[model samples]
Target: MFDKVLIANRGEIALRILRACRELGIATVAVHSTADENAMHVRLADESVCIGPPPARDSYLNIPSLLAACEITGADAVHPGYGFLAENARFAEILGEHNITFIGPSPEHIRIMGDKIEAKKTAIRLGIPVVPGSPGAVRSGDEAARIAEEIGFPVLIKAAAGGGGRGMKVARTPADLAEALTTAQTEAKAAFGDDAVYLERYLAKPRHIEVQILGDGQGNAVHLGERDCSLQRRHQKLWEEALSPALNADQRHAIGTRVATAIADLGYSGAGTIEFLYENGEFFFIEMNTRLQVEHPVTESITGIDIVQEQIRIAAGAKLSFTQDDIVFSGHAIECRINAENPLTFTPSPGHIDSVHVPGGLGVRVDSGIYAGYTVPPYYDSLIAKLIVMGKSRNECLMRLRRALGEYVIEGVETTIPLFIDLLKDDDIIDGNYDIHWLENYLERRRQ
Candidate 1:
């Protein structure tokens, strides 16, 4: 086991990683920017370091400062909670070169999975189903047109290195392909510094589904289950639930087993998520998140497995303590990402939290870093907390989620709590009959 672990991020996830490390008897080093000088995680960590000024580029994302902090604190491992450098292959390699363990997958796997083109090819090689379209990047407008024709109308042009719905466009008909292609390429270059784009058949109403897996780099892995993350706005997931209301027991087992087997075959280590788009009872591979996902708590709530702890143990050369049969899924879990933003206009609302109140009951959990006087800086993400609730059934979980959301209060700044509360009243959401486009359409209807 590592003597001390340095957390290289901020916000609620930093606190999440800190708690995991503390439970394992590992000392913690919290790295923060000037804006987070009084943050909760920094205050609770065994040691703290001010990396740089408030800007993420000069601070949380600064590799040299992180290395210096590790060296100064004598930390042996680093835990990248979710964003920032979590999926950066070079960051993982540099830490490895400096003889510090990165509590994640190998750099090789990260590199391969980071590229959409290579990841699709790898998924196909592993017998995973993928949306049929261009086998590689489409270099010309004419080539994109050709592929779009073959794939049928309404194809999606996606950036090879894109995420969060950026650098993506959809051509609903042959006449729209040229503009869509050019705009996607332009956005791709600007957002990711890569003009490489690919085409795929766009399903009209697909649901976003992802499988969570853990590996020990010793040819051993297990799948906890899947999450239905179809709710989103501008490609950002707001609501997530485990034991998706869309899949049956047989379907769940089939997909989970396949994902676990595939990860084990690739010798993947630590925590990873294989995301897919599902429609008409078919699953198509979209991409793979090479690091832990923002919605990991829902998986943990259902499986009763500490994913972060497993990540540390794997990095420390521990074999998986359990096998596929030993794993069991229970009940249903739901997580609402409560962001510090205007509920109506969806604008960032960062400021001092005057008074904060979190609800607690059986199977309800709140992961947050803000206190009464904590000033939420404008330089970071607006996600203030995660509210998770579990129940013996999906219906019970939904009711619990409603009660929990009603009780969660963060004053002196607006939040998205009202949006979630309104959502729970809708028949579509209650019946779990929503697709990926449901939330956008719902919001549009509200605007009307």
Candidate 2:
């Protein structure tokens, strides 16, 4: 086991990793931007290093700063707890060159899965089901239009190398496709430095489901089941629940196994998530998240697994403790992503947090990077905390989550709390009858 691991992230995820390291008897070093000095992750870590100023490019996303921090702190490994450089293939290679473990998959895996076109090609080659659309990246709007005509109208134009909603546009008509293509290309170029964009048949309504997998380096892998993340805004996942109340066991096992086997055969290791779109009993591969997910706690709550700890062990060349047979899923788990944004306008709200009171209970877990008196800076992601609750049934879990949300009091900044509170009361959410567009329409309906 590594004596020390540097967390190349901030906020609740940083704290989450630090806490896991502590439990594993490993020392931790936290790298934060100047704006995050008062962050809870910094306070709880064994040691802290300031990478740079607030802008993510200079701090959290600064490759050199992160590597320097690792070297300066003598960290044996780096745990990129999602986002930033988590899926950057070059970063993984740099860590390998420095003889430091990158607690994720191999650089090659990240590269193959990082690019949308490449990911789709790989999936198709592996006989994995994929949504019908362009065969590869479209160089121009004309190309995108041609592909859209072939696939049918109402297609989605997406960046070939980005995720989390960036560089995605839906063209409902040929006229819209032309403009959307240009905008998508520009956005993709700015965000990923790659102007290449792709097209896909836009599903009118689908359930966003993802499978969790743990792969040991010895060519062994197991699926931890699925997560229902259909509750989203624009493309950001606002909430996630385990066991995908939408998919039956047969469908879950089939899709999960296929995704795991395909990726595992490609030499994937550590913890990763394979995201899929479920529509009309058919599952389609979308993309794979190559690092720890923000909603990992929900997976943990149901399986009694410490994902961060497992990531550490896996990085240290340890074999998986449990196999597919040993794994057991118990109860239901739900996660609400509490962002620093207006519940109504859905705009980012960043400022000082005057006060904070976290919820606690038997199955309630709050992963946060902010505390009372800590400022929610406007420089980064607006996410403040992830409220996770577990129970024997989805109904009980909903009650727990509702109570937990009520108990959480974050002052001095607008939040999506009211949004979740309202969502909880919706019959569609309560009945588990929702799609990716459900929240969008629901919010619209709420306004009118």
Candidate 3:
């Protein structure tokens, strides 16, 4: 195990990583920007270092400052908590050059999976199902039109290196193709600094499903079932639940086995998610996240696994602690990403948190970094906490989640709590009958 680990990000995830390290008997070093000086993680860590100013580029994303912090603190490992440098292959390689361990997958795998075009190709080679579309990035509008025609109408144009829906466009017909391609490429260049874009056949009513897997980089891996993250707006997941409400036992087992086999064969290390779009009866691969996900708590709640600790162990050269046969999935678990945003307008709400009252119970958990007097800086992501609830069944889980949501309280800033409250009242949400586009449509209806 690492003697000391540096948490390379902020917010709830940083706090999450720190607690895991403390439980593992490892000392922790918290790196933060000036704006997060009063953050909860900084207070809990054994030691804290202010890397830079408020801007992410000068702070969390500043590689030099992070390296300096690690060097000064004598930290042997870095646990990037799912953003900033988490999946940056170059950052991982640089840490290696400095003899500092990055508690994530191999840089090569990160690079491959980070590129949407290459990720699709890799998934196909691994026997994973992918959507039918262009073989590679289209070079021009003409090439894009040809591929779209072959793939049929309603093709999706996506950035080869995009995420969070920044560089994605849908073309339902030939007339929309040119504009969609140009827009996707332009947005891709702005967001990822890569103009490369690829095509995929868009599924109209697919449910977002992802499988969580852990590997030892030594030919051993296990899948912890699937998460239904279909509820979204602007491609950002708002709610996630384990043992997807959409799949049965056989489907779960089959997909889990397939994902585990592929990860093991590839010698992947640490925690990763194989995301897919499921419609009708087939699953089409989308992309792979090479680090921990925000909704990992739901999977942990059902499987009784400590994903963060396991990531540390894997990075320290340990094999997987348990085999696939030893794994067992228990009750259903759901996680609602409580963001600091207005429920109605969906606009960012960053300000002082005068008080906080997180819910607690037998199967309820809240992972947050906010405190009574801490101010939620506008310089970072709006997510302030994660409310995860578990129950013997999905219905029970939803019931518990509803109660928990009512109990959660945060003052001095508007939150999306009201949005979740409204969602729980919908028949589609109650019946688990929502798809990827359901939330957007629901929100539109609410506005009207």
Candidate 4:
């Protein structure tokens, strides 16, 4: 076990990793930007270091400063909590060269899975079904048009290195393919510094389901069920739930086992998620997140597994604590990503939090870094907290989530709480009859 671990991120996830380290008798070092000098995680960590200015390029995303902090703190391992280098293969390789353990998967796996084209190829090789499209990246608009025609139109042009819906465009007909391909390539070049883009047959009204897997890097892995992350806006997940209301027992088991086995076969270690788009009782692989996901709490709630701790243990050469048979998933769990934004307009709300009250009860958990006086900086993501609730059934979980959202309060700044409150009452959300496009359509209807 590592004596000290440096957390290479901020916000609630930083605190989440800190708490896990404390429980495991591992000291934690928190690295923060100037804007987050007094962040909750920094205050709670065993030690803290200022990395750089508020800008992410000079701070959270700066690799040299992170390495310097680790050197100064004598951190034997680094835990990148979600974003900002968590999936960077070069970062993992750098840590390895420095003889410091990266509490995640190998750099090879990260490199392979980080690129959409290679990930899809790996999925196909592992017998995981993928959306039909071009065999590889199309070189020009003419080639893209040819691929779209062969795939029967309605194809999605996606960045090979994209995420969070940045370099993606959909073309429903041949006329739209050329422009869509060009725009996707431009966006991909700007966003990821890579002009490579691939095409895929877009599925309408698909439910986004992802299976969580933990591996020991030696061909041992286990799946902890799946999460329904269909509630999205602008390709960002807004709400997530475990024990997906969409899948039956047989479907869940089959998909879960297949993902676990494939990842283990590839010698993947630590925490990873295999995401799929499900429609008409078929699952098509979209991508794989090679690090801990933002919506991990819902999975933890149902499985009672400390994913962060497992990541650390795996990095320390520990075998998986349990096998597939030993794992038992419990009741339904739901997580609402509370963002500091206008509930209706969805604009970033960055300011001081005057007063706050987090609800607590059986099976309700609030993971946040904001306090009464914390100022939400506009330089980063708007997510402020995660409200996770679990219950014996999906109905009970929804009820608990509604009550919990009502009880959650944050003054001096607008939050997505109102949005969730309204959503809880909607027939579609309550009945779990929503898809990846459902929330956006609902919001659009309200705007009209």
Candidate 5:
């Protein structure tokens, strides 16, 4: 086990990793920007270092600064808690070269899975179902149009290196294909510094389901069920639930097993998620997140597994603590990503938190880094906390989540609490009758 681990991120996830390290008897080093000087993680870590200014390019995203902090703290391993450089292949390689451990998958694995085109091809080679589209990246709008015609209308043009819905466009007909291709390529180039884009057949009203898996990098892996992350806005997941209300035991087991086996066979280590779009009782591979996901708590709640600890252990050459048979899925779990934003307008709300009240009760967990006096800097993501709740069934879980959201309070800033409160009462959300596009449509309706 590593004696000390450097957390290369901030906010709630940084604190989440710190708590995990403390439990495992590992000292933690927190690296923060100037804006996050009063951050909870910085206050709680055994030691803290100022990386750079508030700008992410000079701070959180600066590789040299992170390396310097690791060197100064004598950190034996680095744990990137979801974002920044979590899935950066070069970052992992640099750590390996420095003889420092990276608590994630191998650089080769990250590289392969990070590229959407390569990931889809790998999935297809492994016999995992994938959406029909171009065999590879289309070089021009003409090529995209040809592929769209062959695959039928309603194709999605997605960036090969994109995420968070930034570099994506949809074309429902041939006339729209050229514009979609141009827009996707331009956005992809701007967001990822790569102009490469690929086409995929878009499925209407598909439910987004992802399977979580852990591997030992030597062909041993196990699946811990799946999480339903269909509740999204602008491609960002707003809510997630485990033991998806959409899948039965047989369907879950089959998909989970296939994903686990394929990842293990590819020598994947630590934690990873295989995302799929499900519609009409069939699953189509969307992409693979080679690092821990933001919505991992829901999976942990149902599986009784400490995914962060498992990542560290795997990096330290430990085999999985349990086999697939030893794993058991229990009750349903739901997680609401509380963002500091206007509940109705969805604009970023960054200000001092005057007073706050976190809900507490059985099966309710709150993971946050904000305090009463802390100011939410506008330099990063708006997520401030994660409220996870578990219950014996989906209905019970929703009821518990609703109660917990009502009990929660944050002053001096707008939050999505109101949005969640309203959503909990909606018939579609309560009945779990939603898809990837459902939330966006609902929000549009509200605007109208």
Candidate 6:
């Protein structure tokens, strides 16, 4: 293992990576923006360095300063947790040029998978089912309209390089396609610096299921099964659970094995997630995230595997200790993202956290960085903590989660606790009979 690794992000994930390094006896350097001078992750890390000011472009996303911090701290490796520079190919390439290890996949894998359209093509070539619509990126509204008519009424205009629901628009009729295409392209350019857009057959009510894979640099790889991230509002996942309530045993196994083999063929390494859209009974590949996902705790909760440790070991060229057979997924696990935002408006509510009360007991795990006095910064992501709960069955897990969420108390700044509490109250969510639009509709009705 490396003597020390620099974590290039902030919030709960930074603390998550820090705990992993500590368990592996690896020292960690936490990098922070000037706004986060006294953040929990910084104080918890073995060492810390401030890269820039409050703004992300000047600070957290500042590649030069991040590399400089690693160089000055003499960190042997750097772990970009999920967002920020995690999927940046140039970032990984720079680390390689500096002789410092990047605790993720190679730049080639990141580049291919990071591009939405390219990943769809790769999935299509691999015989993986993809939403059939666009052959590739389309140039004009006229092209988008022709494709939409062929694909049927409802179609989605998606950015060729989009994620986190940034550059997407859905059109139900031919007239809407032209306007939606223009809007998607504009948003794509603003968000990703690329105006390219593609088309896809939009499944009105589909479940977002993702397969988590762990692979050594060599050809050895294994899938940790699937997580049901169907609960989302505006394409952002709100809650995630393992062993999707939608899939049967056969569907799960088929998707798992296929994703494992395909990525292994690509020579991918470390921890990565292969996301698919499942509607009715059919599954279609969406894209692949070439880094650890924020919702990874649910997979780890049930598998009895420390994914961060596994990711680190793989980065160090250490063989994965568990095989496909050894990967026995037990029980059910659920994660509720607790963010510094208003439940009613779903807007960012960044301020000081007056007090924090966490629940405890067997099977109840809370991954958080904020405490009583931490000032929630408005410049970064709204996520403050992640509450993960596991049980022997889905029903039991839901019940435990309900209890745990009730016990979770964050005083002062507004949080999504009320929203999550309302979510738990819904019979659809509790019974897992909901889709991506379930939460949004539910919230809408409640507001009305």
Q: Sort by lDDT, best first: what order?
A: 3, 1, 4, 5, 6, 2
User: If scored against the real structure, what TM-score would every candidate get?
Assistant: 0.99, 0.97, 0.99, 0.99, 0.99, 0.98
- Which stretches in model 4 have alpha-carbon errors above 4 Å? none
Compute the lDDT for candidate 2: 0.89
Model 3: per-residue Cα lDDT over 1-448, one tens digit each? 8999999999999999999999999999999999999889999999999999999999999999999999999999999999899999999999999999999999999999999989999999999999999999986999998888898999999999879999899999999999999999999999999999999998999999999999999999999999999999999999999989899999999988999999998889999999999999899999999999999999999999999999999999999999998889999999999999998788999998899998998899999999899999999899999999999999999999999999999999999998898899999998999999999999899899
On lDDT, the leading prediction is 3
After superposition, candidate 2 runs with Cα above 4 Å error: none
Candidate 1 runs further than 4 Å off: none
- Clashing pairs for predicted structure model 2, backbone only: none
- Ranked by lDDT, the better of candidates 1 and 2 is 1
Task: Rate residue 31 of model 5 by lDDT.
Answer: 96
lDDT winner, 1 or 6: 1
Tally clashing residue pairs in candidate 3.
0
Candidate 3: TM-score? 0.99
- What's model 5's TM-score? 0.99
Q: Scored by CA lDDT, what does every candidate get?
A: 0.94, 0.89, 0.94, 0.94, 0.93, 0.90
Q: How does residue 219 of candidate 1 score in lDDT?
A: 96
Looking at model 4, residue 229 earns an lDDT score of: 98
lDDT of 1 at 306: 92
Give per-residue CA lDDT, model 1, range 231-293, as digits (tens).
Answer: 999889999999899999999999888889999999999999999999999999999998889
* lDDT measured at residue 421 in model 1 versus the true structure, 0 to 100: 98
